[model samples]
Target: MHASITAAGQAGPRLPPVRNLRATTTQAPVSQTVVLEWEAPEPGLAMDHYVVYGAALSDFSPSQATLKVRVPWTTHLHSGLPADGRTWHYRVVGVDAAGRVSRFRGSTQVSVTTASRGLPRIPAGNLVATATSAQQPDYAAEFVLDGDPATFWHSQYDPRVPMPHALTVDMGEVRPVTALTYLPRQDGEHGGTVTAYAVALSTDGSTFTPATTGHWWALDTEGTFATWPATRARYVRLEVLAGYRGHASAAEIGLFEPPA
Candidate 1:
């Protein structure tokens, strides 16, 4: 017999697919740009677009999302949502290019609360190394948390480097964080930019998990951001999934308080 080890202790020391299918509550960020990514609702449906519905009532249906947007395929970057700082429930549905709505494969409902922070924003400081997990960039990662909007953490301009550059950030200690704002390089050029990405939270720097897998919107705007359910953790990892221009960069990162 071979005894093995893995990183599966964050979600209360158990994996997903609990017997209970009760609604789960998540906190949205104070920022309007929110990323909603989920496992395929149903496989082999040839889903064309994904629609999200958000409302104060948990009973709200996908048709009553009040604020609905069709993402490209299976994920969406719900931008411009009003930051009312209230609890909102979101439901996702798939629609084929032929205008056919597909059925969800399984439970696909999540409760998310908008950022409700009354105090000012807090700086997480420089805690991420330049190269982490498998990335070892020659440039220093300290440029990311230096609180300088003019500076940025840059990776070697290697378009050949397997993308989705993953950078694990440490918060010094465990703290309740609700939102993360990514300030793309405000410089005129756009070679080193992260267009799409996701984040995972961790209490220990080694073992990290996302409250729920979330999509970081494309770095179109100079100072775009994403807010999810507030979580207590000492580390956060940003995985650049797609749209890597030439390198991965960040002008500034803001870790918000419990959006209460």
Candidate 2:
């Protein structure tokens, strides 16, 4: 009548939360883009993936309502967010194969503010663009002012030019420029997307003065805005300090004028 000895089942190893979670946001043309990055936890059982949660409220809890994405890597780019000048909060958690999830708490949360969607873009008909280099007849500099978001200006690739690529546009005449919008390549390709940049204005196309400098979120598919005090310049230059995949490209570059 005695029962055979039974072996107890062991539980899977506990996984720890990610560390050094960081975030950055970019105010894009149609939305706010957020880039989140973090370091993996101490070596342990492999994780199936990581879940990203986001909300407009700082005290929001991580749940199905706030779930943003599930990724297998340490970095993620969340786009198409509302650009209503509100602070966005984000959290990340790890999940194992057995559906075990890491703890969700304040330690892994980060936040960023979305900027207002600025003025409308003016016509680019009267502008002419030139670049430091070009790939060929296919991706020349003139495409940036052609009013076509499908075509773009790509830097030289045959010889494999280095970074710091420059694209200059003559607005036909010196007009009061309040802001500039840079539309990234729209073909879903990540290469040649500007990350760090500096904008300068020149009245004579030779003498230039720095207007503003900043960084755009990497792999952002929407347009980026750079504002400066109303400056009169015939030429505007977009200097690519750094770009994704060590290349530079732009679909369109347009300027904004003060409200009439």
Candidate 3:
């Protein structure tokens, strides 16, 4: 039969060569100081260091025996960690150079929690405005004190003096603030020229009523800085008139829950 088909095509049956490990995590429910990534295995064939393991998802396991880290490859950040909520399990191992170890099993499972305090106390006074010559570094102003004389209100700004620079907080009674958070201050000198801001809600703080008159918002940028969402009124006033060229700073001010 043609010499047995050329000896079975020169004895074709030597299949055994497949190696490509992987471990990735760029985004997920993860948020605690997360940053674990990897992908390396194809060059000179001498990998001899790289092992990272994690546990806390109700006892996750992969043979249960991995926590080594020793390679030329790097990308790790598992800092602090302890919001008390758990869901963490990562893996990456590839030891060569004689130790002979290759394992890359991380199907993705990161859900570490803690980071949502949003509105608790926030009600001290209101004095986050600096600009002695503002060179940079000064931002802290936030207030929502409802004493209901009519609905007290105050929003400060200092471009050297006058546009809207007032600060007050008494909160005697009116109770109805839904949201307010401001913390802008890196130094002074208009601190990066503050930039777009407004929040006015009164029930008796000082004869005021203009809860966002047309569409003005800029809490300083980072994540949810100015949110009235519905407007209930109790005395919440934060006004930086405009910033980001000079003078505008805040440190703390948050008030929430009061819409219906």
Candidate 4:
């Protein structure tokens, strides 16, 4: 007797199809510096670039949107924005080389404010500079003087000297200073070296102790530049160690202080 086996088989279990999901944006609450981030869709899918959209919350929508320039990654930092007390809306999308675009992933809102305006206010203070002399023939070539006579160095050279000279300004009282800016001598050949410069703290302008010391280099032909620091000082001094070869020239000086 020949026996044949009848074909009897059951269908395999059906599985769900993989969905093409959009990416999402992960950003912190509104701040001066906004950090926008997102995640990849799948393990093997490559993201070629990202597009960021931002607008005022009042006007933000899918059809009406402001697009930032496309970036190469999923994260970006938007900084130095105006603190106008307005809420901003942001969204991100991912793009691939195969002309495939991921759905919008992340959304956020942020607020901005001026760093100085937000700080506490301090009592009004006086800025004084004392000088020994106050006479110069070439006013155009010499540094402009703007300080109290008791504490600042005054140029006193008579008109006989055609070349203008440099002057020192003693910042009176120890106060916090965030930035110091100065103009270099105009005559390129008269490039002088700053022998010693310091931010000092003084109860009285006459007595000054160096609080901070900085190395001085030759200024470029450009008019002026600035130095920034994290700490504050009461007084600042720039001593002339050497002068340029040609007629001397100097310009105004300024100091920037953060709010109390």
Alpha-carbon local distance difference test for all models: 0.54, 0.75, 0.40, 0.40
Superposed model 3: Cα runs more than 4 Å off:
1-159, 162-164, 167-175, 183-202, 207-233, 238-246, 249-255, 258-260
Better of 1 and 4 by lDDT: 1
Each prediction's total of clashing residue pairs, residues at least 3 apart in sequence or on different chains, is 7, 0, 48, 27
Tens digit of per-residue lDDT, candidate 1, span 59-100: 543332133665655555555543444344556555444544
| Residue 174 lDDT in candidate 4 | 58
> What is the TM-score ranking, best to worst?
2, 1, 4, 3
Model 2 agreement with the true structure over 68-105: per-residue lDDT tens digits: 77788888998865443446678887766665656565
Model 4 misplaced stretches (Cα beyond 4 Å): 1-128, 132-174, 187-196, 215-219, 223-234, 245-249
Residue lDDT tens for model 3, 96-121: 45444443333333444333233333
User: Highest lDDT: which candidate?
Assistant: 2
Instruction: Show the colliding residue pairs in model 2.
Output: none
Please tell me which predicted candidate would have the highest TM-score against the true structure.
2
> With candidate 2 superimposed using the best TM-score fit, by how many Å does residue 129's alpha carbon deviate from the native?
0.7
Cα-based lDDT at residue 155, candidate 3: 28
Question: How many clashing residue pairs are found in candidate 4?
Answer: 27
lDDT of 3 at 232: 49
For model 1 the local lDDT of residue 21 reads: 20
